[model samples]
Target: MINEVTRALVAHLHSRTPDLGSWVVVHSLSAADAAPAKDKLALCLLAVDEHDHLRNSPPVEVAGRLQRAPMQLRLSYLVTYFGPHDEAMARLTRVIAVFHTTPVLGQDELPLTLGEQVERVTVRLRNTTADERNQVWSVLGRPGRLALFYTVDVAPVRLLPGLDGDGRVLAHRIDLAGTP
Candidate 1:
């Protein structure tokens, strides 16, 4: 199931941008009794579009931080879904990031059944071409229909820039309360 969703999303993104790269992520959702991060994730989509209001945008560059607020604004559309397969869900949910953008990764811990895991998946994408950045901004900023789906319950996954002292990639842990 995870692979299927990942493949579908990759395909969709690739279809839109042929020259993009992506990374797969798996999350745990046992601690979270319910999904709370969904709101934040959904809000991000909206932020992306609303933040800058799309002035003369530029193509995506391989090395650069995207205007974070705008991307976050664009992400706000995911709050309405509680399951996968919803139209909005398909467009908003991300288990992998394929484009070229610096990803902001973090997590919180949650209490749950003995060994159950509840998690949220987030993928950040940026345009690799100088022109694509502006084009992506335009696409994300505008109001239109997007695909989305209900997320699966699993371990929370985080994307970090490098590894930590523990020899693990420095990723945040998201729990029921929040990121910790």
Candidate 2:
């Protein structure tokens, strides 16, 4: 599911920023890896963490049946532009602008596979402290470069049946003995 989300996001970025051309690469962050060639960009999924606020949500009710709520996740990514510093900055700025304009990826904008699985996704720029940012890069064994951190919230990724049988209210009864 995470992979699917990443791919869908990459596709969305491609469509939204056609001026950048075909230069989006999805892979793990590696310091040893050579920089992306000119005219290329990379999207490295740095981490996937649960959204703390929704971690303890109650089971969802659907069609008279209770089902376990899906896991709400916040996916982090390092958007890197590899090229001349000036051009790279330009591309990065455009990337920021695009996300700002379309903060939410609606069901229609999602890839077919993702659209079926998720109702919508919210993208936001994450403000990480220098220490946190350094830690992330350290974990990847890479030195941080000119990159932006963005988080995508994917809610309710899976659903589990809460009970076996359907719950129904068959009838209503009223007591009028006193009135009689």
Candidate 3:
């Protein structure tokens, strides 16, 4: 579900910014050592936290079984550009514009892989200080790169059920160190 949110963001960006082409990627700034040095944009999921207010939401009913409530996640991302500084900054402007216009993404706008529980996700540009950004860089053990912090809030995470459609328990595998 987390990755699906990222993919949805990337897909939305690509759909909105045609000139960006296929350069947008899900990457870590620290892993660019061996990658090609072409002009591209990188989206790094810096942190994922549960939405505090909705953490204890009610359970769900699916196929006559009571399932635990969906876990709502807030996904934080850092968008970075690698290559020519000037053009990269211009692209950042476009990104900001896109998000500014459509901060809320409906289920229809997102990837089809999203579960039934996720109705929508909110995107917000977080106001971050240089010190906070630097702390993130410090935690990554890498130098700070130019980045914008965006958070996608309320992405629902629904766990799969143990029983199959036919009311049978799914297979399980347990590996133990010692013989039974």
- Once model 1 is optimally superposed onto the true structure by TM-score, how far is the C-alpha of residue 159 displaced, in angstroms? 24
TM-score of 3: 0.79
Tens digits of lDDT, candidate 2, 1-180: 789888887888889888667778786767777655667778888888998899878767677665656779999888887777897898888889888999899889988888888878898988889998888789878777678899989866775445443344468999777763
* C-alpha RMSD of each candidate structure in angstroms: 21.0, 7.8, 7.9
Q: Considering TM-score, which of the candidate structures 1 and 3 is the better prediction for this target?
A: 3
Number of colliding residue pairs in each model: 74, 0, 0
Per-residue alpha-carbon lDDT of candidate 3 for residues 1-180, written as tens digits (9 for 90 to 100): 777888888988999998768878888666434443468888888889999898887766777766667688999999978777897788788889999999999988877766355888899999999899999888766767777899889667777668432232357889879977
Q: Best to worst by TM-score, what's the order?
A: 2, 3, 1
Tens-digit lDDT track of model 1 for 130-157: 4543443365453222322222222322
TM-score head-to-head 1 vs 2, winner: 2
Identify the candidate with maximal TM-score: 2
**Which lDDT values do the candidates have, in the order given?**
0.31, 0.80, 0.80
**Model 3 spans with C-alpha error above 4 angstroms:** 31-36, 60-66, 115-117, 163-180
**How large an RMSD does model 2 have?**
7.8
